[model samples]
Target: MTRNVGGIDRAARIVAGAALILLALTGAIGAWGWIGVLLLATGLLSVCPAYLPFGFSTCKAK
Candidate 1:
């Protein structure tokens, strides 16, 4: 799949993901913590399935 994440979008996702995981590990969040894992995955992969259906693309494809 093409990269649909970039710039601050990607950066924010990564940071948020990390924060969520840390918080979850500390028992700050429950099942919702899994959302962070998903974010981490999407950020690392540079692809967001949600963006596809909405025709959203943050990265300018090479």
Candidate 2:
């Protein structure tokens, strides 16, 4: 898959994802917080399936 996620977006996703997971683990959030895995995965992969249909992308043209 082509990368649709860019520098800041990727970083935000990773941070948010990690925060959610930590909150879940600490019982500060519901199990649904596990959904953060999706964010983490997308960030790491640099490909966001959600962006496909609308042709959205955060990457700079290269």
Candidate 3:
């Protein structure tokens, strides 16, 4: 997939994802924290499915 996430968007996602994963691992967020794991995966992949239909792309055009 093309990189639809970039710059601050990418950094924010990474930070959010990492925080979620860390919180989940620490059991500070409970079972709902699994959602954080998913976020982490999507963020690491740099592909947000939700943005597809909306035609949103944080990446710059070539």
Candidate 4:
């Protein structure tokens, strides 16, 4: 993975993912919160499969 996620985007993903997972554990958002795992994984890994189709990159030019 070439780090398609960066800067604020990465931070947001981590935060959102953590929150969703927490909520799910607390029985607040139901099974849908499980999707947060995807966000967390993508954020930590700095890659997103969905972005592949659009050839998108949030990472800064190196």
Candidate 5:
């Protein structure tokens, strides 16, 4: 898959994902926080399926 996520976006996703997961593990948030896994996965993979529908991409044009 093409990388539609850029550096900043990836970093933000990783941070938010980690925070949500931590909160969920600590029982600070609802189980829904587990959805953070999707963020983490997208960030690491640099591919956002949601962006494809809109033809959006954060990566710099090569």
Candidate 6:
């Protein structure tokens, strides 16, 4: 898939994902927080399926 996630978006995802994961691990947000894995995956892959349906892209034009 194309790299549709831009630098800022990637960074935000990383931060948000990490925080959610940490919260889950600490029992602060319950198991649902583990869903952060999705964010982490999207950030790492530089693609978001949800964004696809809407034709959204955070990446700069190449």
lDDT of 1 at 2: 80
1-62 per-residue lDDT for model 3 (tens digits) = 77688677877877887787788789998777667666667678888888898999988777
Model 4, residue pairs in steric clash? none
**Model 1 residue 53 distance off true place after TM-score fit, in angstroms:** 1.2
Of the two candidates 4 and 6, the one with more favorable TM-score, higher being better, is 4
Misplaced by over 4 Å in model 6 are none
Q: For each candidate, what is the lDDT?
A: 0.88, 0.93, 0.78, 0.92, 0.94, 0.92
Instruction: Choose the strongest candidate by lDDT.
Output: 5
Cα lDDT of model 6 by residue, 1-62, tens digit = 87789999998998899899999999998999998999998988899999998889999988
- TM-score-based ranking: 5, 2, 4, 6, 1, 3
Give a tens-digit lDDT track for model 1, residues 1-62. Answer: 98899978888999899889888888888767768888888888999999999989999767
Better of 4 and 5 by TM-score: 5
Choose the strongest candidate by TM-score. 5
TM, every model:
0.87, 0.95, 0.79, 0.94, 0.95, 0.92
Kindly report which residue stretches of model 1 are placed more than 4 angstroms away from their true locations once superposed: none
Worst 10 residues of 6 by lDDT: 1-10
Whole-model alpha-carbon lDDT for candidate 5: 0.94
Candidate 5 C-alpha lDDT tens digits along 1-62: 88899999999999999999998999999898999999999999999999999999999999
Give the C-alpha miss distance for residue 45 in model 5, angstroms.
0.3
Ranking of models by lDDT:
5, 2, 4, 6, 1, 3
CA lDDT, candidate 2, residue 22: 88
Candidate with more favorable, higher lDDT: 3 or 4: 4
Angstrom error of the Cα, residue 38, model 5: value is 0.6
lDDT of 4 by residue, 1-62 (tens): 67799888999999999999999999999999999999999989999999988999999989
Tens digits of per-residue lDDT for model 2, 1-62: 88999999999999999988988898999898898899999989999999999999999999
TM for candidate 2 is: 0.95
